[model samples]
Target: MTDTSIPRADESLDDEATTPVAVDEEIEEETDVDAEEANGAGREKKSPADSELFRQSEIAADYVEGLLDILDYDGDIDELVSAGRPVVEVVGGRLQSLVGQRGATLEALQELTRLAVFRQTGTPSRLLLDVGGYRATRRKELAAVARNAVEKVKEYGEAVRLDPMSAFERKCVHDVVNAIAGVESESEGVEPNRRIVVRPVD
Candidate 1:
């Protein structure tokens, strides 16, 4: 009788420990599921915005491709979203003509692409277009010019009026001027004649 009772008590203790282990396993499984769900939710939140941008890019690319074909231009086009905006780049030989002087043609093409997107999606888009990396090269040039203007303004302690620049060029200058201390920049005049004035901040 004693031996049988001891065995029974041990079995009861085993059952108690086993029950807690099972509960712990179930809790761990639930925690894993919850984590996965949280990750899924995070992905879902970001994907829609990115997808819309990508869609805009695709539409812009198609429009550009059609233009290139009509123009008998040989080029490769790449579409992407960068800096919260859609961008299309065209690379090929003899593409400088597409970029035109100071990227005027490229700017026009970009506007047309944006209009195409708006027509399709009923939403206006801020799309950037580059041909043969013109914008990238121009940006570097503009950055140097901005620095030079800022230096001049700092040295003279007077407002310096720069030549009329495109809206893109003006923005680049404004950004650079804003970054430096003791100076600020503003756009003056209208489109095609709009320029940046760098001055010492009072």
Candidate 2:
């Protein structure tokens, strides 16, 4: 388990640049609203993260909903929070096409959803999008891969370089390795060529 005492993102994010615009004029304008209005009547401006997260979920939901309509598939969309990120999940039968083989379609849809969010909010969102249980399945697969890598590292006492993976896959492996007791993981090389390096903890 992660140490609970560590400085989490919630605490250290004050210095993080989350907004697309270095100095958002809209935020500055919001600060100048009449005190009475700002207190009671004016629109409460959302933080960049909140805005981007919301936009991402909405766009993904819309896209999925349209696809379902076209495919004549039935599903219910439930939007909510998971892992401290906005998630839109679709639950139904005959919707496997949305997820595609090995989640390739799901990953593609996620990228498009992120692009949609970026277009509207001008900020890149760290949005977690799941459909047809693809993410849950992938999580299990990644956990298994991490365990195998950790065993390899323990046996050889040398770093084990993993096969190339997408950023999402690398992130999953990194998270799993970080949670283990005697191993750590890092990504090396560049995109489309990058791989995870699993090694014994220092």
Leading candidate by lDDT: 1
Model 1 C-alpha lDDT per residue in residues 114-177, reported as the tens digit of each score: 6667656666576677789776678678889999998998888999999988767776667677
Which pairs of residues clash in candidate 1, taking residues 3 or more apart in a chain or in different chains? none
Worst 10 residues of 2 by lDDT: 24-33
Candidate 2 global lDDT: 0.63
Tens-digit per-residue lDDT, 1-202, candidate 2: 1111222235433333344322221221111113323343312454565555555677657766766676788999865433334567889888778777667677666655544455454566555567777766786798799899999999989999998876667766777788789888877887567789999988
Residue 27 shift from truth in candidate 2, angstroms: 24
TM-score of each candidate? Answer: 0.77, 0.66
Clashes of 1: 0
Clashing pairs in 2: none
lDDT of 2 at 95: 72
